[model samples]
Target: METRTVVAECIGTAMLVLFGVGSLVLAGDYINALGISLAFGFTLIAIAYAFGRISGCHINPAITLGVLLAKRIDIRRAATYWVAQLVGGIIGAAILFLLAKQVPRLQTAGAFGTNGYGGRSPVGLGAGGAFLAEVLLTFLLVFVFLTVTQKVALVGVEPIPVGLAYTAVNLIGIPLTWASVNPARSLGPALFAGGGALSQLWLFLVAPMVGGVLAAVVHRFTHQRPVGQAQQEQAAEPPRVGPWGRMRGGHRPEAGGPEAKGPEAA
Candidate 1:
């Protein structure tokens, strides 16, 4: 694995939490829910463009898991990304925590932008409702990401749909469970919020992973691969491309296979 790729994942995931979650923690009262949703969407778009070339800019562990299941990236690489994203999320949350402390009378204890259910939920959504909501919400986000990135024709415009999908999920999920399509996003804030947030953290993590798996399975059936292509993709070293230029690793090559023109070739 390349060091730069890992670093990019770390930085990109940190930025996602810092700006996306930060908007809710710092400015939720002023910006409101829609603004917070936009914050996350906008941050994802920025990260996709900024680090897309280097790491495919997954940032979220759920996305990485989906990508791994799709055979886009190997398990070792996925594991590395997961670690990087978790660390980055914590780092971003720690920074957000410090900043929140600076504001007088600002509360960061119970909420801190963490996902939850029951009394912690905004609409009083129960545990079962929260779980189902997260699964469906995350399914939409991951499904969009997989669909957009897989098509060779949609290379440059991938971020738009993926980011919008994220925004859409947040819009619906905020009232239910504060929208935890990304586990790293939830874990970061919960660690600092402690107490109930920690207890409720499992749903955020497990549901997203389930959603990711479901997306991958559905994608396989929906987007059928060419006969023999699966074996080739598994055997050969796949080409890499920036998010704008070509499908990321584990995607069909631009021309067809490994010999297809890549970012460097272009």
Candidate 2:
């Protein structure tokens, strides 16, 4: 299970960065942000649905950590997921590097589609705004995730809800944080951007986790079931065993055998 989850994260994040940054490499002079934001949103749900049964395919450390605190995952497994996400991001960027090398302008910069802040922002947004944007965007994503994976999970049409919620997150966050919401998503781009992107990378990592933690805490306290759940559980069982020992507990006497006092007839 552990190994499969790690493989899933690595593969999923790879696909995410590949298509996501690849879209950027191919972006025209103007519509880069719009196109890339859409890729990021849709790719999130695509990967989650594909590997969700395996690793829950978070593809984002902040999401993974939030789930961990909500008691959805153990620490060891969460650590593995984070490593897989980061490594996958790098590998994705490396492959993008190889592919973009064939292009003209992209070859020089190897525009593997990097992330940035301050003077580097695509829209010229500042660092402080970017950090806040990341925190809120990732928070909304993790919160939406928490809703879908609940046991006795919601009925049909569940995936659409989570997917659309992610899309909505993108709609709001794109201008400011470039709609990162996922650490590995930003990390890969920052690695290629280097310099300021690398420096501001800390904000991308820290803010999301902070928001995720806060959302988790609030969700936990507010989403508790009524104490009557115990009564509802008790009401579901059938009547107890008659002359037989406790319904499911003690062993029953063997028929026509020693315990039944008829062994000689055999």
Candidate 3:
């Protein structure tokens, strides 16, 4: 990975956590679940425009893993992106921690937006339910991202659907698991929240990864060929004769139709 790309990933991920988690920790009560979900969704849209060109704006580790499994990125670059995203999440959480200390209510609040289940869950969902929620929600998010990004028609506005998907999943999964579709997003707050948050961090990590892999497998079957692959396939085909020969029109390359073969010439 290019140094600038890695730097962009770091900054983008940091911004995601800063705005997304910050909303949950600082203003969650005022705005409620809808507002928090919008906060994360809009943050992703903004970062996609800002850093999408530089690093494809994979601020979330799950997104990177999905792309990796689809063979869009090699393992080494994916590893680099994962490290940058994780570091960025920690840094963003640290900054939130420092800022929260100034506000007594925010500082006293539990978890600092960390994801959890059972007693820790906002809705008291059990571990099995939480895991299933994470997997299904993350799968939806990653699948939307992979498909929309590859769709030629959605070019420029690709981020919008991905952002909306994030918001929708959060709406459905928030009360259950706090909707940790991104492991890096979960890891940051868990490190500081400790206690139950730390103990349950593994679920956040494992479930989203599983979701990403499932999305990748589904994408591999349904995805259209990339431009390079399409071009290579076109090149490998036998040369055609007429304007619509060997494809639509039934004009064979014989009987002076185009390139008459020696079988006919002889």
Candidate 4:
């Protein structure tokens, strides 16, 4: 990958952790879990549009794994993204850790926005619930991305549904497991929060990957289109207005090309 691409991924991932985790740690008392979900979801929208063309804006390692399993990206590139994302997560958490120390209550609180289950969980959810939540939530997020970003339909406005999907999962999963769904996102804060956050970290990591792989399989069966057919469809279609006035390929004319003037020779 190009250096610029690597840097974009690094910066984008860092911002995700910075804003997403920061919202939960700093303003969580004020904004609550729903607001935190919007923070992460909106941050995803900003980064996806800002750096999406450069590196596909896969700030989450789980997303990268899903895309890799879908064969949308090669193994080597996926590895590079993983490294960049992990480093970015650490950097993001380090910054959050430093800032959190300034607050007297947060300093001793040791939250750092880490994810956990059972005693560590906000609602005392056990291992099984947290594991299931992570898997199901990650699966939905990845499946939406795989489906929405395709060339067939809703071509240009992928970021909207993709971001909304993240928000929806967070909205439901926050109280249960703090909405992990991304290993790097979880690992970064766990390093700082330690204790049970570190001990229960394995569940966050393993379940999300399993969910991503399952999403990839489901995407292949439900949404995958043959390359040649896709190309032919694109050629047959004409550029038309999509959401937000973006140009996207629309269906071809029923009988004639765009230049054809007569409607049934009337």
What global local distance difference test value does model 3 have?
A: 0.86
Give the winner by TM-score: 3
Badly placed stretches (over 4 Å) of model 2 are 28-32, 107-112, 151-157, 226-266
Q: List the residue pairs that clash in candidate 1.
A: 72-250
Worst 10 residues of 4 by lDDT: 251-260
Q: On residues 11-59, what C-alpha lDDT tens digit does candidate 4 reach at each position?
A: 8888989899899999998999889999999999888888877888888
Q: Is candidate 1 or candidate 2 better by TM-score?
A: 1
> Candidate 2 has which clashing residue pairs, if any?
115-189
Give the alpha-carbon lDDT of every model. 0.87, 0.71, 0.86, 0.84
Q: After superposition, how far is residue 113 of candidate 2 from its true place, in Å?
A: 3.2
- Tell me each candidate's TM-score: 0.84, 0.77, 0.84, 0.82
Clashing residue pairs for model 4: none
lDDT of 3 by residue, 94-118 (tens): 8988888899655533588999999
RMSD of each: 11.6, 8.2, 5.4, 7.4
Count of clashes, each model: 1, 1, 0, 0
Task: Compute the lDDT for candidate 2.
Answer: 0.71
Off by over 4 Å in 4: 108-110, 151-155, 226-266
